[model samples]
Target chain A: MSQAPSDIDDLIDLMARLPGLGPRSARRAVLRLIQKRGKLMQPLAQAMQGVADTARECLQCGNIGSDDLCKICASEKRANGEICVVEDVADLWAMERAGVFGGRYHVLGGTLSALDAIGPEDLRIPALVRRVTEEGINEVILALNATVDGQTTAHYIADELAERCAVTSLAQGVPIGGELDYLDDGTITAALKARKGF
Target chain B: MSQAPSDIDDLIDLMARLPGLGPRSARRAVLRLIQKRGKLMQPLAQAMQGVADTARECLQCGNIGSDDLCKICASEKRANGEICVVEDVADLWAMERAGVFGGRYHVLGGTLSALDAIGPEDLRIPALVRRVTEEGINEVILALNATVDGQTTAHYIADELAERCAVTSLAQGVPIGGELDYLDDGTITAALKARKGF
Candidate 1:
């Protein structure tokens, strides 16, 4: 095979490391980047550089932002005496996109996992505990995933803040516009158990 | 939704422009980059910048490189009286990966497509014809794709260089390790017509 220029190959390797991309997709992306170097590639590089230089983890909420405090944590309007706990920044972003949550957030970075040897100390649990009191938080809402580790982490956090604040979790039920026939057995059971008046 | 830092949004928009990536995947990719800013994101940004500053299309073959002539075009050993014609640089790279061809290449950049109004002049067809006599080529091999536009471009090129030299095309048949049942009808017909002695 002819030698692909080293820089181009390096870019492809780095791109392949991204979450949803593999070697084949990385190659395709690189080819497109090269073709549109002037319009897209250059702008993408500049954007990446700008983000790299400015992006930082929020000290209070563990959210990603340019400043020490994420915009949500800095906003007085969002601090409605509630703090929503999530697994990662991605989940935090998902909640923000829903536009339903008016409270501040505490990103755990990851859920507690015994199999992976991850514990509360390994995450931002200590910071979250401090934030509850420092920010005068009234309720701690666990918006964790419906996974074993996510539940374990939520239970642990609930116990930690049992006396300090009101602890709650998101209601488990059928998603909006979802079909019962296509739903998983676990989800169907949850939906049945959590059934309410129509 | 809380405002994602504008730079972060910009990066995500650029990543979504890549061939295989969508908005969700781009968000995930950007999140990963933010988390690993020092390790992966910085290097990727630098690599992209490097390529953006240096990468240019090879004047002769229309292949991507950092110099005027691509390595394949500059190499004396590859000037073996044969030129493989491919529809794009990605296809040229695929052929190189197989390591079966031992000659130079002519990248058309794209196939002739009437619907897209992509004509031979829009690609490197004129340059390819010019190379035929200028470089003392013996045969022009068409390795264009199996698409309608690909075949149409191949026929057009063959006719253009018909009297100048021998024009051949890649043999169409079942792919290696491919199952007959899974093969398309066109491929099955082509394979039967081009059946060889085992």
Candidate 2:
């Protein structure tokens, strides 16, 4: 009936909250870290600590970075009058990995959702709008997901920006309901290359 | 022709090194973090930082813990004169989730591997032997993987402890070349229940 120590229990609880990891997996992960303290666990812990101390949200692009502005937003060369608008940072990273999108990005954080009560305002839609006007962007690429919410958000953004800038989307290579995280770099690049008007 | 900034590249390089994550996946994951900085990415970064600061290896059993000794190793109730040995923490967690074993665990870190230049010393074999004699252990259960190296390591441990204590192994329910992490709780429990002399 006695409970595990508070710290261990806390760790397990927190780990359980991570995606694809349950309480059991968390326990195992914790145990493994303890066992390989010198080689794996300690280094992992140190990395976590360093990141914790320095990691922050990039003020301009919402990317997780160690500085106020993310590497992408701070780069002058990336300000090529084109902005890749994505539903999530993962999508933006996917574009970057393709190494073809010679522009910056706008991370919307999430898609519009009626079920989740998410709306355009709930996402960074307003910020995205502001960026298009302030940054003198000519093209705003909609790289949102193909999900209902994703499309809804994309349509909303496109509608809001229709009068101001050229709007396009990644080609139909991403499978329906597929997350950007699941796509290969090649597929993302191909999709981006074949983008069509929204 | 320009490369990604050094810090971003460094992050990608480190992420690519994670198991099951290649350069592509790492880049995608990092990008995801950037986009969802406020919700998913920022929280993840904070969680990683917290774990980094607090996570440490259990000196006694090689489990990850917030302190020097892991929760299992520190608990007096877990000291039941029986130590279940596993190749990885994932396996140890599988056993715990099965809720079959009442004893504590000894994480071997990994199995002996001539190809990887790994040896008994590289694993926790020496610590395990020390635990057997020092802790007055009665039984040592080998719950390693079904790989050749896992079986070889089990045999080595059995030979070392033949005269000292009861040595047993997980039963045949574990599929050939199966990893304990992939096994369901029921199967693991069944395997544990049907365990026989090594």
Candidate 3:
């Protein structure tokens, strides 16, 4: 087998650099792209170009969008005075997918990690505090991950905004569809402590 | 949570349509792309566009290339009178990656599948015969898959080209690093029957 065409090889190399794709899967994907050049390939290229050109962080909320203010931040309907704070845009997207929260979001970019030397200034924590006061926020929901750093950041933000608004964290428990047999000791303990009347 | 921007959603939707990616992974991939716009996303988009504009099927062997004749078909050094036959361009790429066989290829595009109503005429069997007789081929290596349809196609091709040149197939046995305890009955039986003097 001779070297694949440079253009196709380049495409495969770049695609392999994506989050989940490896070399073999990238080759498969490139073949699939070549096979469907008229439909999937062209459209995907255009979409990537579009996003690369226009996508930006929401200055107010740190959510990704094409404008300075993300749609969530721009919308009056979403300014329900209740801001759900998250660790990353991916987490914010996950929350949106659940579609349970009626309020807007604040993306902190990352947690406070003293080991990594990441302080509050490194994240969007200052911006979050400013938004709480300026926007007259009534509640700040910490939807950060359950990691130690995540909890630490949540606690730090809670202390900073304790006087300004109500501070709450997502309920800790066993996940939906999770089995007790598979649950870790910490999760089991937390779920037991947070048990409610059925 | 508010609705995500349309462009970002479109990118995620297109990314999800690729093989081995689903909605969740697609979102993660898109976010990563957005984060690394200059380093990865833009280059990927350009590569996609380039491949889409230039990539085509090698008219001679059904392999993918930027020209009518794939590099393998055009290269004189690879004309070793041995043609490896495979079911798809993916299989052809797999053989190339192995870098063992020093010959050209004949991509059948797919196997002879009666259930799917595919036949010899539907595939490149006639093309293979033409290549063998016209190109003065000495051997035809049937490197098709181990599926029922793949074997059936291989036999059909052998019957078609037996009088013209020698015909052979890839050996059937346990794959490399395969554990005997995990081996299926069919693979174990085939490997036992094809045992060599090791």
DockQ of each: 0.73, 0.16, 0.65
Give the alpha-carbon lDDT of every model.
0.92, 0.74, 0.90
Model 1: residues with Cα > 4 Å off, grouped in runs: none
Candidate 3 stretches with Cα past 4 Å from truth are A176-179, B174-182
Give the residue spans of candidate 2 off by over 4 A: A1-9, A23-32, A35-80, A134-137, A173-198, B1-198
Maximum-DockQ candidate: 1
Q: Residue A28 deviation, candidate 2, in Å?
A: 5.0
lDDT of 1 by residue, B36-116 (tens): 999999999999999999999999998899999999999999999999999888899899989989999999988898999
By TM-score, is 2 or 3 better?
A: 3
Backbone clash numbers for all candidates listed: 0, 18, 1
Q: Write the per-residue lDDT of candidate 3 for residues B64-181, one digit (tens) a residue.
A: 9888899999999999999999999988888988989889999988989879999898898999999999999999999989988888898899999889999999999999998999
Docking quality (DockQ) of candidate 1: 0.73
User: How high is the TM-score of chain A in each model?
Assistant: 0.96, 0.82, 0.94
Q: Which ten residues in a row have the lowest lDDT in candidate 3 chain A?
A: A1-10
User: Given candidate 1, what's the lDDT at residue B98?
Assistant: 91
B-chain TM-score, candidate 3 = 0.93
